[model samples]
Target: MNWLLVVVGGMTGAPLRYLTDRAVQSRHDSVFPWGTFAVNITGCLILGALTGAALAGATGSHLQLLLGTGLCGALTTYSTFSYETLRLAETGARFYALANVAASVAAGLGAAFLGVMLARAVWG
Candidate 1:
C-alpha cells in the first residue's frame, strides 16, 4: 500500500536525518545550523531526482510515495531551518542568518536542478 510505503520510508528517513544531523553538527563549531541545511539540500536533491525519474518513466507511484513523499518529507525540516535563521538573527549573527537564507535557497535550487539533470541523464 502507498501508506505503508510512506510509513516505512519515514521510519528510515527520520532516524537517518537525526543521525546525519548529529554527525554533521558534531564536526562543526558554529550556530549556523549546518546539519539542518545539509539535510534540507540533500532532501531537495533526492526529491528532484525522484521527480525526474518519474518523469522519465523510470519510477512509479509506489517509489514516489516511499522516497519522495515519505523519505524526503521526513528528512527535510523547514521549521528547523526557519528557527535557526531566526535564532541567528536574534543572537546578533545577522550576517550568518541572511547568508543562510540566501545560500540555502540558491544552493537548494541548484542542487535540485543538478539532481534532475543527473536523473535524466541516467534514466532517460
Candidate 2:
C-alpha cells in the first residue's frame, strides 16, 4: 500500500536526517544552519530526480509515495530551517539569517534543477 511504502521510507529517512544533521553540525561551529541546509538541498535534489523519473514514465505511484512523499518529506525540514533562521535573527545574527535564506533557496533550486536534468538525461 502507499501508506506502507511511505512508512517504510520514513523509517529510513528520518534517522538518516538526524544523523546527517548531527554529522554536519559537528563539523561547523558557526550559527549558520549548515546541517539543515544540507539535508534540505539534498532532499530537493532527490525529489526533483524522482519527479523527473515519474515524468519520464520511469517510476510508479508507489515509488513516488515512498521516495518523494516519505523520504524527502522527512529528510527536508522546512520547520527547522525556519526556526533556525528566526533564531538567528532573534539572537542578533541577522546577517547570517539573511544569508541562510538566500543561500538555501538559491542552492536548493539549483540542485533540484540539476537533479531533474540528470534524471532526464539518464532515463529519457
Candidate 3:
C-alpha cells in the first residue's frame, strides 16, 4: 500500500513537475532553469504546509500519509537534483551544478517560508 501510494504519487508528481518546468521555461528565457526551481520550491512549500496541518491536528494520519508521504515524497526530487548536479559536474558544467544547488536551496527555503506564512494567515 505504501509502495502503491508512492508510485501513484510519483506518476502524478513527475509529470506535473515536467509540465510546470516546460511551461515556465517556455514562458521565459531559457537562460536559467526557472521551471525546475519553481517546482522544487513549490514542493517544499506544500511539504511544509502538510507538516503544519498535520501537527495542528487539522488533518488525520491517513491524509498525511497521502499528502506528505505520498504526494510530497514524490514532489520533492532530491535524487533528480543530485543526479543533475552530478551530471553537470561530470560534463564540465560546474557552474550549472552550483547554480542548481543554490537555486534549489534558496527557492525551496523561500517557498517553505511563504507556505508557513500563508498557513498562519489562513489557518491561524
Candidate 4:
C-alpha cells in the first residue's frame, strides 16, 4: 500500500516536472536553467508544507511517503541542477553558474521556510 502510494506520486511528479520544465524553458530564452530551478524550489516549498502538516498532526506517514519521498524525490532534480551549473561554468558562463547556485540555494531555502510557516499557520 505504501509502495503503491509512492509509485502513484512518483508517476505524477516525474511527468509534472518534465512538462513544467519544458513549458518554462520554452517561454524563456536564457540559459540559466530556469526550468530546473523552478521545479526544485517548488518541490522544496511543497515538501516543507507537507512536513509542517505532519508535524502538526494534520497528515501521516503515508502522505509523507507518497508526496515527500516519492513525488518530491522525482520532482526535484539535483543532478540536473549540478549538470546545468557545471555546464555553465565549463562554457564560460561562470557568472551564471555562480548566480544559479546562489539563487537556487537562497530561493529554495526561502520557499521552504515560507511554506512551512504557511502550513503551520493554517494547520495550527
Q: Which of the two candidates, 1 or 3, achieves a greater lDDT against the reference?
A: 1
Q: For candidate 3, give the lDDT.
A: 0.75
Report, for all candidates in order, the number of backbone clashes: 0, 0, 0, 0
Q: Model 2, 6-70: lDDT tens per residue?
A: 99889888998999999999999999999999999999899889988988999999999999988
- Give the range where candidate 2 is weakest over 10 consecutive residues by summed lDDT: 47-56
lDDT of each: 0.93, 0.94, 0.75, 0.95
Instruction: Give the higher-TM-score candidate: 1 or 3.
Output: 1
Query: Model 1 over residues 1-124: C-alpha lDDT tens digits?
Result: 8899999999989998999999999999998899999999999899889888989999999999999988998999999899999999999999999999999999899889988999999998
Sort by TM-score, best first: 2, 4, 1, 3
TM-score winner between candidates 2 and 3: 2
Q: Which residue segments of model 1 deviate by more than 4 Å?
A: none
- Which is superior by lDDT, 2 or 3? 2
Q: Identify the superior model by lDDT, candidate 2 or candidate 4.
A: 4
* Residue 121 error, candidate 3, Å: 1.8
CA RMSD of all predictions: 0.7, 0.6, 2.6, 0.7
